[model samples]
Target: MRTPLAAVGLVALGVCLMANPLFLPVAVGEPDPAYTHTVQPVGADAVAGLDSPAAEARNGSDLDAVVAYDDLDPAARAAFDRARDAPEGGFGVEDPDERVDSLAYPTDPRLGDGLLIVERDGERYELWTRTVERESDVVLVQRVLVQPIAFLAGFLAVVAGAAVALRGRLGGE
Candidate 1:
């Protein structure tokens, strides 16, 4: 009796994990409102300007410049990458006034078409930009773990259910 009940429970657990009916949170990404906002739609030319070296030189200080996505420092790049992976388009920024991580994926897709804002030490730098693409480690890791777990659970459930069903014939009720 107990064995059969346990088998059913295992099957239920396996199916639930596979289906993810509850929408359990996975390691998607974090959100930082400080670096996130809807931007005004601008022309592609405007975005190109943000990536120009002239924009950096015109900032009057190297500490503050409108940098392109490819030109972003390692830390800033990682943050934006995480934002791109977020389920709800979340962003991550350490400090708006000191780091480029302060940038966020535009809340609206249309807003991200061309312009982006950067701030460093109270100075706002409007930068032209385009899209950035990167794979998320969090997402990769989730798939790696879930797939195996689901397979193992399903196998065990079937075995257990069979054992319960055959217990009487096996003379081990």
Candidate 2:
């Protein structure tokens, strides 16, 4: 009984080691600064995009994909175009680590990809949202949830294995 239990524990341990739950790749490739945008605080009541047509049109996009200019509503497209026309307005540096007056950079110059200037509660903000390569859903789940659970299970099995091997010496029937 103890031998079989020990074998099971060994197998579980091997599975855990092979899974490598510690280093899971969530986002792939080097993070580009072009996609890195400043989310500066415009005002306390800057909730313009919460229910606006522009926000509605931008729904259901893949995490890796940016909202295309054509996909936005007329109002959004106009704002986008206007923002693209003059890409000099700086994103205010609020943090000590942030550089002063960081300008917006487009991912694709021909596509007119760049920051979107928005005014809410009479305050302005420059938004050049992040776009990066991310791992698939299956791999994400395996790394985040499944692997950790398996590792824990393997650890528990090892403990059980030791207990089983020591049962006779520990005065258990």
How do the residues 22-69 of candidate 2 rate in per-residue lDDT, one tens digit apiece? 655444444333233434333334333333455457573312233444
Number of the top-ranking candidate, with lDDT as the measure: 1
| Candidate 1 clashing pairs, residues 3+ apart or interchain | 47-128, 50-128
Count of clashing residue pairs in every prediction: 2, 0
Instruction: Looking at model 1, report the run of 10 residues with the lowest lDDT sum.
Output: 35-44
Q: CA lDDT, every prediction? A: 0.49, 0.47
Tell me the tens digit of each residue's lDDT in model 1 across 1-173: 67667667766765665564245336566532334422222223444344457646757443343446566677655555554455644443435454344444443333233344444344333442223333366656556776667667767766666776577457776
TM-score of each: 0.35, 0.38
Clashing pairs in 2: none
Q: Each candidate: RMSD to true structure? A: 12.8, 13.8
